[model samples]
Target: MTNTHLPKPEARRQLLLQLLKQHKQLSIHEMTRQMGCSEATVRRDLDLLEQTGEIFRTAGGARYDDPLRGISFHEKEQLFWKEKEAIAAKAASLVQQGDIIGLTGGTTTFLIARALKDRHEITVVTNAVNIAMELAESKKIQVVLTGGVMSNETFELSGPLAEAKLDGLHINKMFIGIDGIHHQNGISTHSELEARMTSIMMSRADRAIAVFDGSKANKSSIFHISPISSLEAIVCNTPLPAELQEACARDNVTLHIADGEPDAL
Candidate 1:
């Protein structure tokens, strides 16, 4: 026994990681029975995986991380331009003139900024470098950049500084971009700091809107930012679930399903 003194939890965790890497997903019940461990132990191990961003926790199992590793602004914009714009359009309609809006980082929020060019008297606050750069040209709206540490991969600013800057402002509406949105997991992002600021922004705003396409729904991500119930609206494409619609109605959150066209909607 080269390492006989090693703790059982450590050995079981390593084994669990190996199985997860091999299968790309593993259920709690299966892992518990196979590892000869308690249910609580298996759950704790899976929770560790979730914290490390190695896997996304689900109802009874975990899903594999994104194949490409992480998301980038250019890649996200290229990946789902139409759906993002449609979702953004729906989100934009929820904002009235003279509103103070808090927009999140990432391409989806950038699309919302682009869609709001014609809207008047709106003061936009954000930590997205790209969105700030884009909105800088808008004479109709005031763009406030929350100063903070920036993520080179996504080109978004997130950190203690951003959070501090955001704490000073109150907004009428907030639009956030989530990595995944499961009915159980709610809103999640890969970056912990991004999640923190997003949660703060939601709390600071009068109305919170989560904007993402259908691809984001029915999925969970590594870092959970906030619950779905916190938002006042969920904007997405068509074919939404009846259960989700009922849930939103019960939450008093408007669920906008934008198929296409401005007048048709």
Candidate 2:
């Protein structure tokens, strides 16, 4: 007897885990189609996985999660490709030749590092493994690494050691990446160690520039990095919320909106 009923809950969840790992993310519709089940069934499966902390749900889909696999840097690099690139371009254009800058870790800042690859005689201090390595091969730029415990998920250095390394250093500009930005709650990132490092970067820079996409606006994350008053300028692909625009104006923060394709991934 060949019974083609839906797989049992345990089997279904295991299958879901494999799907999330294989794709990094999966939407309810896609999962439903793949499993030959209704959307309701897929939702229940996702809910179960999320309860166990095996997945994290975003607005449209679920992201794979575990001790080894957190919010992925690789996934973020491809999430808002054009928007992040545009924001990076705008941020790069703001940098003057020979300026000493600080960059925190994030996919957007990684793009900023790429955008500044050819700039001459610039010194960049960073705690991000990927960003430092990206600029390591450059002849025109000098890269400084903040040695500390590395976060496998983010590929960045953090902790008290990284904070101490920035103690006596000053920057002409600091470009920051945020997991959340709000009109009142301010800028934040998911990890507390990263948030602490970000706050230090803001304090040591003469000008603090925030680089992010539209998706992060009006949201709050687990850890607060800095207040709205810390920003010198903000570069993003979408328009800021009206309240945020007003707040920026009051705080004397310049906002630059770049145009790009909408979020597809």
Candidate 3:
């Protein structure tokens, strides 16, 4: 008889972390091959690991959920920390006492939500579960969530249900984050459903402000969310690329570059 018994769950989890630590990220199929298990078993392990904050699930793989390697939201928050905070502060200053703001999910907007926690008499509508929870302690700031299925990668709610929640509402300002921004390619994101939700927010708001860092400048992503012309303002913590600067000028979009290292230009 052939020996086919698999390792215990705890031992398997330890092995999973070891694999993630070695490879940075691995897909379900890869895990299955390595562990000699079914894809479903791999997925279950990933889910359990994620619940314990041991790993972060990506679009098709799992990463160590570490600040150094994970591309998930938590790991992203550790990258360019100062730049993001500066952008958040500048973005927060633009809000008035009673503005109704719409914030989309991403590290930048998450910081923006935190920056506004002290303000009073403002309404914030968001699709991020983390952002909503961050602002929950503030009695002055009203946080509304778009009801939908939650995304494991972003901890954001999406799909048609979330999109429908924004239809009847009007916003004074919409602060959005993107995966990439280019003069010709326009704004782009990694998720198609998230892109659709962003489009809806842009159309419903009076002023659409993009809050992102310099790394995204001139880069392009898979899903194009909106044209460059859709933005009224952009808050970034790095010097704008010449093309982006010129595009902002030509389009009459106000560009606010936060204070940062000269290289960020």
Which one is best on TM-score? Answer: 2
Q: List the candidate 1 regions with Cα displacement exceeding 4 Å.
A: 1-68, 260-265
**Segments of candidate 3 deviating more than 4 angstroms:** 1-70, 260-265
Clashing pairs in 2: none
lDDT for model 2 comes to 0.83
Question: Which candidate would rank higher by lDDT, 1 or 2?
Answer: 2
Steric clashes per prediction: 0, 0, 0
Candidate 2: where are CA atoms >4 Å away? Answer: 1-25, 28-69, 260-265
For model 2, residues 44-107, the per-residue Cα lDDT tens digits are 8887776554566765778875434347698677677888899988888888887998999999
Local distance difference test, candidate 3: 0.83
Tens-place lDDT per residue, model 1, 1-265, is 2335778777777778777777866678877877788989888887776655556665577655663466667656665678778878877877787889989888888889998877788999988888888888788999998888988777778787888887768988889988877666678887777788888888889888888877566566767888778987878886555666666677776677776444211
